[model samples]
Target: MRKFIQSIMLLALSAQLFAQSSDWVYATMTHESALSLQSSHPSGIVILATEGNVSAVQIQHQLAPSLKSGNLHGPGYIYRTDAQDAVQALTKNAPKKFNILDFTITEDMFVNEVLGMVSQENLGNTILELENYGSRFHTTSSGRQAALDLKEKWQEMAQAANREDITVELFQHQLTQQRSVILTIPGTEVPNEIVVIGGHLDSGDWSLQTNAPGADDNASGIATMTETLRILLAKNFHPKRTVQIMAYAAEEIGLVGSNEIATQYNNQNKNVVAMAQFDMTNYNGSSVDVGLINDAQFTSSELNLFWVELMEHYNSTGEHRITYGTTACGYGCSDHVSWTENGYLASFPFESSFGEHNPFVHSEEDTFAAMNNDASHSVKFVKLALEFVIEIAKVSTMSTQELNKTDIQIVVQNRDLIYQFNSSNKSLNSMAIYDSSARNVLSKNQLNASGRISLQGIPSGYYIAVFKDNQGKSHSKKFLLK
Candidate 1:
């Protein structure tokens, strides 16, 4: 009787192993990462092929629960297709060797002007608005609406700036209903070279139809990007290299959106210079203010060094000083992995260390109130992003040549506004100040020859000073009243 029972159990186990459905999906991940997943749940994963340090595996959709749970705990796998396809993709897009650009600091004044416009209130409001959605999970109706709403918001901002060069569009994917959003600002000088800054917009939990307020997991990251876009448009800033702000969809489900987009860009032979991903930027669970992922397999050492140098030069010491430490998120943790696999230089600046990430992520508990209902932590990331864009995509001379030629300087000191011109040919006829919302606060039709005006009743905050020259051309500068 004991022998018969053993045989029956063995037969059942074999049947279970071979009875898997044809709904299996192919993916490629590091050998170590694949082994870790299989060791944790032997019945959930199967390795199909291996080449060098990478392995291709066939996974069932039923294992989504395990994958989602493991994402909250340890490293995750990179999703791709068939073993042959995976190897071919890797070979076709093998990373090219190139020299790192010269790290220099020549745009201090422009960088400072943009960094001063960072607002905590704006970031918090964005987070609140995104959390109001039912769920941003892929394949859901709400997820698709969220993407459409964001597209409209970006289009409105571009219109307000009166810029015809800026274009906003939705990137549709074949696998998921939720579409990714892309806002492109065409470069003035180097239109071929591209720079990308992105974060995932979709959120998830155990249930797809119910509540899954992923405020900290990803809403925070999207908020950071939105605030950056807001300030850049308000300042009427134009870059020399094409800059794109991408809000990817379906990141929670094995980086599906980003992988498809990256693969397409690679196939087109797009010249993407560098990419940066901001995911989970609100929660401060670690000792340091910023955590820079230093994994060489999925990140660029040169890119990491560039950010470190930026921090040392721009945010070294002050009330807004940001301290950073190195960390690693195994393999295929976020959207940055997608870009890295496509032979692009990408970097991820995380909110906290690996083991110290937010404990309430991927559930209803990941709400704004869970992080003390504040966006102060995200302010640092906004500042860092400003510095990155200003340095990488230097200001375009075509758009600001008039102002550059005039060389006008405006300063506010002790309730008095002073203006000076390095070129004697330029003369200021009228001056006005506008708030960040583009509302004109104070205006003066006539000005004294001494180039001074009294700001007696103006409040202390961020404002843009617009000066009209004798030629009827306008020049603006951002200033803070303290």
Candidate 2:
């Protein structure tokens, strides 16, 4: 009897192992790519069906690492159930044509106000808070908590801004335990036309355990979007087009969250005018300050040009100026691909060039301290996001007339910086200067009627001059220090 009981236990264990090993997931990729994957991992992958250039494939769960590495089919593959489902998803996911509008920078005063409100301290704090999580893996409890926490934070922001109409909700996924967070600010005018900005919230590592910090891989991107949200809410920005900020889940594993959301929007015929993605924004791994993904197959060229033109108009001259270059991220590199694949105009501005992205990503070492504990690099992307949303969404009721009325100007003469304020109702209480990284380098409390300050020791670069008035309102102007 004892021998028979032991044999039964052993057989049960073996059955369980077999079940786990046989677990497979359906995905969509190019026909050639699917064939190549199957050839490379003969027993691990199987081609299910083919429709033109695309093919439905079934991959063993154990071979996910091999699929993720080597950029086999890009950073992610759209998860599906069977060949029929994958084919339907592909057929309905046709790209849409976009009516490219003028990418000009028209809201200078409002844009400047929002850009100046971007705080590196806030960004750093958010990144650190996110890193505190053990690991935001899609199937982990911490991952779901992260999404819930973000939802609460966004709700608090909306309440603080007194925009009670703003709605924040969790977009649950069927495949993953983690949920995506969405915060929407309804437009006063064209509510149907939507503008989206997003980044992944889930982090990952090789072991799929609870050690991945992903501070730069995606925490920085989320932090950037958070800061952007804070400033927009603080200013009570009313836009003509609806603005939605999303924190996607399961991006590290097959871009699952964003793909579902984008597909739903596409099927519902949501008019998403523009979508922007911020990923790995904290690391400056390249010479260029900003690298705009130029993959024509997955990104909109017209939208990319609009970003360049917008930067040149608003951030090109002073310390706020950022250098941009074109780089390509292969198929399904990030969540932007979800929008692009669904026929939406999407763009992704990265921290570095394609090959130069932060090497620490998808590892335990990707921490805030690893990037020198600095949020300066992420600040540039925050400014870019602000520029993109403000210009594309088109402010509706937010008035810059008060700012226009206050004639504040800064002129550089030799080594002295001169400020001229003509508004009689607003008295300049204090003045300060900040560098391109938003670091406060010079500050002065006592203001004389002369309105002159010396910049003898300050370095030559782009700097912003900020003036605080008696009413506690701050005004800023960008100037070149030489």
Candidate 1, residues 1-482: lDDT per residue as tens digits?
Answer: 34643553454345356545644555676777567678876766666556666766655544545543444721256556544454444445566433344433456678777887899999999998888996888777888899999999989989999988999999999777899999999998888888899999898733444687888879998999999999989878888889999999888767888888988988788878888999899989899888888777788766776676566557756655888878877666889988988888888988888768888877788899999999999999999888887778778743443433435677888978888755467676777776533347889876543478777887876565666667665555556677
Q: In candidate 1, which residue ranges exceed 4 Å CA deviation?
A: 1-23, 61-75, 87-93, 205-209, 398-482
**Per-residue alpha-carbon lDDT of model 2 for 231-276, expressed as tens digits?**
8988888888899999999887678899889989988999898999
Q: Ten consecutive residues with minimal summed lDDT in candidate 1?
A: 96-105
Q: What is the lDDT of residue 295 in candidate 2?
A: 69
TM-score of each: 0.76, 0.76
What pairs collide in candidate 1?
none
